[model samples]
Target: MDNANTWFDYIPFNSRGKVGKISVLLLLIAVGLSDFVSASILKPYFERLRPSHSELEGLILLVNKGGKYGFVSSHAANIFAASTILSFFYIHKKKLCLTIAFLVSYSRIYVGVHFPGDVIFGGMLGYLIAIITITFYSKFVLNKNKKKLIG
Candidate 1:
């Protein structure tokens, strides 16, 4: 949020053990999937224009305009996916992770790139993807290991 580079900077280094490494990998995959879904799939399907491109009467551009379509913000989707995964790994840091995601998502609106609806839907989509990825990881990776240990 405050610094764009800090999102996944220290998490990988700080995380410990096999689970931590796998989680970091999965988190990266989640972010990639969110971005791909938002930008490549949904954006093309919806074909909504960015507010800057729409040319509203009093719209002030704080940052350079983005691509043509803005149905779902990739920034929101990626950050939310990262935040959701981080929260799963560090339950105590959920607030910080969510706060970062929210701030980054809001920045898109602040800079006049995406509509509120776009950001909201992107965030929801990212959260859903993260939930699915986490469920699969737990059910397949963690549970299988547990079963082996028990057996």
Candidate 2:
């Protein structure tokens, strides 16, 4: 487990084992793909604007293009998705993963790209996707180890 932790931390620096590298790559790809699909497919359908562009006009701190749709924040969705998957692999560091997830989601609103509601919804969607993926992986890929541990 210590080796796994070491590898996890060093994966981006080219000091990780093959499994760790593969895990990180998969997590990134999954999150990226999900975020892209959510933004492209769902954002247009929802077509909601940020608070800065809404009736709350002066209440929001406008820093960017505020009139654009902001239903599902891509930043929030992608980071949440990555964090969720990391949490499953780093169960002992669950709190850290969650904290990072919160920060990532909050950054979207702080940067004026999305509303609070957008981050909230995106995080939820990301979490659901992570749960489904993790469940499938555990049930199939880790089934043998699970039975052995249980038995």
Candidate 3:
């Protein structure tokens, strides 16, 4: 348990390193863009309502933002996407990245604004997208510049 807690503790300070800080910033930007595109634009088009506003009234009403249509959670999507990209870049600190990701995703539920299912699905989707994006960028873009950096 102590070992587990240690990893979580490291997450908040992982960006202390110059390279790690740069990686974190890049991941944050990528995640933010993805979340904005999905939640702000896509959700409106889909027009799905929140669980609380749905016909089923028995569910827990976490938050009542007045405006319904809470299909995908922006918080979940952003945090999970950031986590995925950070994990790929900082493979040595994968556990810390995952822990931070989980906490960020959970915040949406704790604060209201998104249903449990919405967060889960959004997180999964964001993670998948991040993985593909990171993999391709690393292979094509970074690989081409590796020699310059090393030399």
**Which of the numbered candidates is closest to the native, going by highest lDDT?**
1
lDDT of 2: 0.74
lDDT-best of 2 and 3: 2
Task: Write down the lDDT of every candidate, Cα atoms only.
Answer: 0.91, 0.74, 0.73
User: Which residue ranges in model 3 land beyond 4 Å of their true spot?
Assistant: 1-18, 64-67, 106-113, 147-151
Which residue segments of model 2 deviate by more than 4 Å?
Answer: 1-15, 59-62, 144-151
Q: Which 10 consecutive residues of model 2 have the lowest summed lDDT?
A: 7-16
User: How well is each residue in 36-120 modelled by candidate 3, as lDDT tens digits?
Assistant: 7667886898787866566765556555564577778777777788888877777877888788878887877775666788788
Tell me the TM-score of model 2.
0.73
* Per-residue C-alpha lDDT of model 1 across residues 29-133, encoded as one tens digit per residue: 899999999999999999999998996999889988989999899999999999999899888889999999999999999999999999999999999999999
lDDT of 2 by residue, 1-151 (tens): 4677666563343436755664576577668666776788888899887666677645656466644788887777777778788777667767887898899889878867777989998888788777777776668867977888999
Estimated TM-score for each candidate:
0.91, 0.73, 0.70
